[model samples]
Target chain A: MSFQISSQPIDLAVLRNALAHPHAGACATFEGWVRNHNDGRPVLSLEYEAYAGLAEKEGARILAEACAKFDLVAALAVHRTGHLQLGDLAVWVGVTAAHRDGAFGACRYIIDEAKARLPVWKKEHYADGVSAWLNCAIRGGFSTAAGPPSGPPTG
Target chain B: MKTVRIQYFALLREQRGVGQETLATAAATAGELYAELRSRHGFTLPADRLRVAINGEFAPWDASLTDGVELVFIPPVAGG
Candidate 1:
């Protein structure tokens, strides 16, 4: 499978090795890390949860689409689940192509589509002791930007 | 009645207090099943805010439910 859900810390070198291709001349990668702050709140940590079965299916579909659209030699994406501390790598996307354009374009497509379509959720534990699930806001309640949630406030 | 395995994730799991369950239900469509469970479990998010998946693929909320199928109610995804 081109896409996978990893519960452990992702090994970047291994992922890069998988994308190596004899005919490819360019490699593009994107790594999403657990940031320390969001919407001004000091995020202490993040928890990612996924419906593993469906997530893998959808994630693979996304990679396939990226390959077709960008004419990539290979594309691979891995998303990390469970608790992650600040600065930890949360998601990684790598693509190889004969030229830079395809590699870059496909890499961008995979990460963007994965974020918008993958069957995953993120919960942010703030420094102030409040924790809330991100991106569960009702329509028209919150902007399209991944901002603060509108759900019942909890600590 | 059909027996379906319904799985919950993230917020729905937290509200339902379980990851999944196999249940017999009279609801014919995915939407109907969600309505019944939402009331039973006091789900905060409504049908409009969620998407339903059947047998590991994203299915329309109004799609018919089949016996022995797996159903999931997906919340707004935040993956990166």
Candidate 2:
């Protein structure tokens, strides 16, 4: 699959193999991790959710765009859903191309676009036993902040 | 008249108190359906804050609502 979401832990090797090609001279990959903090608060964990069927369709479209825009042999991306602990892998994007430039550019392009466009939601649980769903009001300001959620506000 | 299968997520789900519901609506377009639901359910978010999808594909607000179609009101996605 070009792009997908998984509740089970991601297998990096599997995605890597999917991008493997004999002509590929360089590979670039991006991993988004569930960190322990956000906006100066200590985070306990995250609960990720998706409007599943649409998410898959949108995700595949993103990969298709990367293919059309960049000279790449293959590209794939997958996101995680459900409860996740600190430092858990939240998403992965892997791209393979004849050169490092295309691979790197496509990798960044996929992650950034996926973060902005996919129909996925994250609920953050704070260390103080507080929890809030992210993104409902995250467009709190008009800054072009590329994210793994740069200004995600919970609640 | 159309019967739409609506699915809610995140804050919308919490506000609606149910993940999915089937509704028979007189509204003709996706936007109209959302307006009716917003008023009836007191959904705090507006059509501008959410994206509408039908049958697993993103659709414009003015798109026609078909019977038994799966409708998803996607509140701002937070996927990384």
The best candidate by TM-score is 1
Tens digit of per-residue lDDT, candidate 2, span A23-93:
99999999888888888999999999987777888899999899888888888888999999988899999
lDDT of 1: 0.86
Worst 10 residues of 1 chain A by lDDT: A146-155
Could you give candidate 1's per-residue lDDT for residues B1-80 as a string of tens digits?
A: 99999899999999999999999999999999999998998887878778999988999988998899999999888887
CA shift of A49, model 2, Å: 0.5
lDDT of every model, 2 decimals: 0.86, 0.85
- In model 2, the clashing pairs are none
What TM-score would candidate 2 get against the native? 0.91
What's the CA RMSD of model 2 in angstroms? Answer: 3.5
Query: What does candidate 2's lDDT look like per residue over B1-80, in tens digits?
Result: 77899999998999899999998999999999999999999887778778898888889999998889988998877888
